[model samples]
Target: MSPQPQAAVGAPLSRVDGRLKVTGKADYTADHDVRGAVHAVVVGSRVALGRITALDIRAALAQPGVLRVISHLDAPRLAYRDNPGAFMDPPVGERLRVFQDDRVRFCGQPVAVVVARTLEAARHAAHLVRVSYRAERPSTDLTAPDLPVNDPLPPQDYERGTPKEALAAAEVRLEAVYRLARVHHNAMEPHATIARWDGDRLIVWDKTQWVQGTQNELAAVFGIPPDSVRVISPFVGGAFGNAARVWPHSTIAALAARVTGLPVKLVLTREQLYHGVGYRPAYTYTLRLGSDRRGRLAGMVHGIRAETSAYEHFLEGTVTPGRMLYATPHVGQTYRTVPLDVNTPTYMRGPGYATAAFAVESALDELAHELGIDPIEMRLRNETAQDPSNGLPFSTRRLRECLRVGAGAFHWDRRAPAPRATRDGDWLIGTGVAVGCYDTLRLGAQARVRLDADGTALVESASSDMGPGTYTSMTQLAADALGLNMRKVTFRLGDSLMPGSPPHAGSLTMASVGSAVQDGCDRLRRQAIGLAVGDEGSPLYGAEDDDVVVLGGRLRVRGNPARTETYERLLARNHRTHLEVLGSFTPPSEPERSSMYAFGATFAEVAVDARLGMVRVRRMLGVYDAGRIISPKLAESQALGAMVGGIGQALLEHTVTDHRDGRIVNANLTDYLVPVNADVPDLRAIYLDGGADLDAAPIGVKGLGEVVAVGVAPAVANAVFHATGRRVRDLPITVEALL
Candidate 1:
């Protein structure tokens, strides 16, 4: 069939839901006004690891307006049926069970809950609840000398060739150890859940990336039918990856409501959020690279370690870049998850690729310096045509274009080759570049579309909008497919009763859910056109179906503009109410025919004060090769926002923990630092404008949210090295290290 004229797909339209958000009408999780809802405060264990020896809740129960105090001694035993975990769950161990035992596995583990008539009453009573513990020295440090080390799972270790022997035979070798500090999500809106029960059925308004996942997990925890639970989350302030998993606070809210026979609301305090949610785990990466005099990579060896909780093993795609990013004859890697007395880590914005890029990209920069070659030229020399891990052709690999375009845009020719040569009044200036990539993840999704006789449409799926503008992008696709004005369509999401959708993370929402919406809208439009052509009284009767086009809810023949009929007249004459279709998309289950990934290049300019040891970024630019840009405005938002986050990862963000008691020292915003308006300088994003890769998905979009943040840190780090001639192997390139 002939494609419809492009109208809204590529347009740079503002968010469809922007008016509601700015006027304080958007309903986030905490904004839901459930009737008869009382506040519940969670009481956390003070010690990192211990066994509860004494229970004390009399003081909490006696506080004014406090209805009840629930703890392990009195809380009911949940069924906790075997839940075949969600997409983000680690396959190794079970999730943390809340209030089911006396053993404490980590600091700030929920020990008790205080439910009261008001939030103030709950807070006061929770502080009065106390317990005694028989504590032991906790293993919280990943590199402590006395801490026992647990080898990583066998499946994580990988090798392609004889890397050690090849490294020994190389003409030049480089080795470096890099460290990254753990960081929290710290979204604007705190994690919250409001749960209530009605005749053995549960209802919750939660801050979750996937409402269906929350519904399934809650049903499994209570041993009830999955259909009996309903989850609603219309708007999410921001999650990054913290809300991807079903955390303990969600279960605790439902439990409180069930025990007290009242709707219960729970919101974690800022300090509690540090220990309650997951974070980007600290990493120790030791890399060894062997290269020739001409900067050709021969072999590489990687030693990686990350911290996870003792109860569970969490892993990510940390070693994928080493296996496929460049051309190499031999590669070996060992990934180990160190068991520590801390909460398990989860995926942050960039996840594994961001961590690996710092080590790999920085090593490549060092090799370029030694070989007296430009960094971009060195990377281009080792670019791979096929994935080395599987020997499969790439659906689309645009790293070369990204690097080339970025070089010209960032003015690479003006950069001085020597370090500490370019200096201002009190600062040294330099520029650096690095390449970034992320896997184009695909998953199954479903969407429902309905075209009413009134010429308006409604499209819905259980997707979410966590600051990426899913509502606006999906609406754009639907409007273009249905050939209707953008103002005539409505898009709704974030409810479990809608059609199923994948989680909002992984950068797959646009590729998966957007495709489903397009399919459904196209089908619905075809139904309308077919109806009009079949009716004997219609002006478009007997017209060639393929030649018919829709614009402004009117069906007309392509060559004959006079043959036209509005949808309202045709549907009213035929006595039809509406046309409805359910669109679904499922990725191939067989082995992938081609490797699919989104690529980008990051360039940064920085200035450093050698006397006071201060580093400041002056400007940054990112060039991305993500497949198609459905909404140019939203795409710019994702790219520019991620660059800011990358700045934080390089210079300011760190989750400080006191290992002695397993306490997080800098948990609040006042102590923890993020990039402020004053800290951010000039920033820009450029897309390669390469059309589409149908092999990746139906909508022809490779994911962008994660890849845009991948190489940001190393670019800044390399710039600091060029500016001051000091190489700091750790993240947040601290002032003390520079001095």
Candidate 2:
């Protein structure tokens, strides 16, 4: 019989910081107690499009404890430079400098900031701060024809055979338009920043996903060296890509600190969150698909129009899956960004894939229904073992296996063939499934590892955990590589002072940062082994390097457990103080011929009430081929969390903007509904038991964070379609649409 695997890589270990988090010991951005910190609240423009005509700070300044009021009229002018590195994108139009100019391009734009000794005083003073603006009608609707289209990223176009020709000859074809509403990340934690300057150095505790990016931006804004800025974000409540960029509030906090000469804390009210940062742009997608009577896809043409701010062009990867996912020979795609008087959009979880999959997967389901074919069978027939776009073989693709496993787990054979056929007590019960796909990306990461003479090891990096068990995963990797117990290893991150690391987005933390930690620990262990084996005073001096193995913090010969010496004993005998190693992992330079991506299939069972336009997810099952599960418990939690987020996207999450004045109607949580505890249903997640080729990264692990939600919305939408014959292309399938 085979022996049990070691308790390291694949174990169901709990998060190392779980206790710290649950016990309120974790230090999130706003939780820090900065000495002599003052509260600052921002005053927003009431008009969407306007230029400030007059500024009144008399009442606000007279208020008690009001330290200062900085507006475009009274604020000191610093050198405003056009640096793309500082902003999310290159300043679209001479950079709308906050407080530098009085022109408001969008509603809720920060017109001024009120700093006070107390939070209440700051709130009162902010309300007292008044501004008059010369108003102008703004174009807020993305669908408006007058909106100018812009291309920020390089134009993307892919074609195999002429889609027009194929569609002309095809036996059957269907074309439909799909629209997705603008959505906010709406992370549990609102954007917060506490800025302080010590001499010439700037210290900021911010809730951000990219610490280095924030550091660079602050340095550029302050016209200081990058080393002079330090950003610390030890814990983040949640980002969902909202905190990925250095938002305008961060700059507001820094400016306040600079003006007041004291640390200033700026926490965006839930209402302010809607306009202060980025969001997933509203999208309009037109899909034309042609297929045979047997439901085999022949051709596809996709046209996309998404929203961006007038000042900056925000682009999402709308054309990616169209080129790579299936075996269609004739494919064409065009993606356009429509700039409106709104805040610029940024990368959300799964970004383009999540939005694109909704249209692609929904279209495929529609085609299957038109051909009178099973959706799973249709996908199976069109599955390409190699990427159809580039004609390159995948390192490892288990999407077919995922489908088979998911179908069995979901009981696809039991699904009724016709829409609205299955019902239970006025609830229409239907099952639907869709494919999930996301590219595996890795960036350069660095780490420092030190093994003390006391037999404990410490690992440090600048990467963040972001509620993904980063600390635990890195600790596990380091412990295994160093041949030490998990208890003897400590992993620290989320500080700019540590070793340089990549941004903790893109699901690349494990593949990139984990490799660096493993490399550093391995080097440290090898150094200890050399010292122990080479020294005459240490035990096993004559042992071969290969024969000398370290386990349980002890150096011993293979097959001789009793003839061993503790690492502490050996180090003390050799008079070696400690072993330290620094290592880095950089991604491959050249682009590969084939595409490597994590794949999954989500099956959702939904029960929709016929009379009321209410939908409830009854059960969800996700089968994933994400390569080598590191921690089953945490992976399951991640999958479940993503599924819940997808549920919100499908049924609840939508940011409503009052286009008349460009104010977000549903800015707070009460008005903008998300999934609550009562909305979540039974969720089951399964990871295929295997490993992928180690060509991409040393860990042979692919990313699973974004992939979990890529196809989820479509799965729910397809189920809703199955429950009711009427098709709803719009997002947040509301009761009005169903009625």
Q: Give stretches of model 1 more than 4 Å off.
A: 149-152
Candidate 2 residue 151 Cα shift, in angstroms, is 5.6
- Report the lDDT tens digits of candidate 1 across residue range 121-185: 99999999879999988989887865545554565788989999989999999999999999788
Residues 250-368, candidate 2: write the lDDT tens digits: 98899989989999999999898888888888999999999888878889999999988888777666688888888899999888888788877887888899999999999999999
> What residue runs in model 2 are displaced by over 4 Å at the alpha carbon?
1-5, 80-96, 151-154
Instruction: Identify the candidate with maximal TM-score.
Output: 1
Give the local distance difference test score of model 1: 0.90
Each prediction's whole-model lDDT (CA): 0.90, 0.85
